[model samples]
Target: MKALLILLISAIITWTLALWKTTRVTSATELSSLGFGWPLQWIEQDQSRFQWASYPQDARLTFVKFDQLPAYVDWGLFAANVLIIACALLVIYFSFPLILRMFRK
Candidate 1:
């Protein structure tokens, strides 16, 4: 029972750390707004002459680009939330048995 409790605590900590790390990663790369109006207008006005000049070209690209969060980070956050919930459930399940036994005695 003690071991199970320890496992549950460890799992909870691991899950929490994973979620925190994921959140930090998201906060670091998230873009406030995408300056896309010019690009879109250019495309509509003249498809052949359309150029992505307004876009940040000089910024160093990351492996996980903030501008592309909807494509990647959103789903990652959803999955992490699910995993955190699952870990919480496991902690409850493992601890419940011991709790019940203590009450029975």
Candidate 2:
């Protein structure tokens, strides 16, 4: 149970850090009109620049399209979180009976 608790706490901390990093990076970046859902006329008027100046890179003049960008989710972090939860649940479930037996004796 102690080990499981430690594992869960570590997983939570790692996930929180990763999430914070993602949010910070995203907040610092910008998206262009290349893949925005706005109308063509609006895009032509340059209204689709979302947080264009917040990022170090200038996405406005980039030739790359938004759809070609990689996904944001970290599968490894998600898998670690799921594994930690499962281990914590298993530890609690198995330890409960042992604890009750000790109390009964």
Candidate topping TM-score: 2
TM-scores of the candidates are 0.32, 0.34
lDDT of 1 by residue, 2-103 (tens): 556655665455444433331111221223321111101100011112234353332221233443332223334444544555566678878999999999
lDDT of 2 by residue, 1-105 (tens): 866676677566544543333211233323322221111111111224345445444333222365443333445545655565556667877999999999999
Off by over 4 Å in 1: 1-73
| Model 1 pairs whose backbones collide | none
Q: What is the C-alpha RMSD of each candidate to the true structure, in Å?
A: 15.5, 13.9
Q: Using lDDT as the measure, which candidate wins?
A: 2
TM-score for predicted model 1 compared with the true structure? 0.32
Q: Candidate 2: global Cα-lDDT?
A: 0.43
Give the whole-model CA lDDT for all candidates, comma-separated: 0.38, 0.43
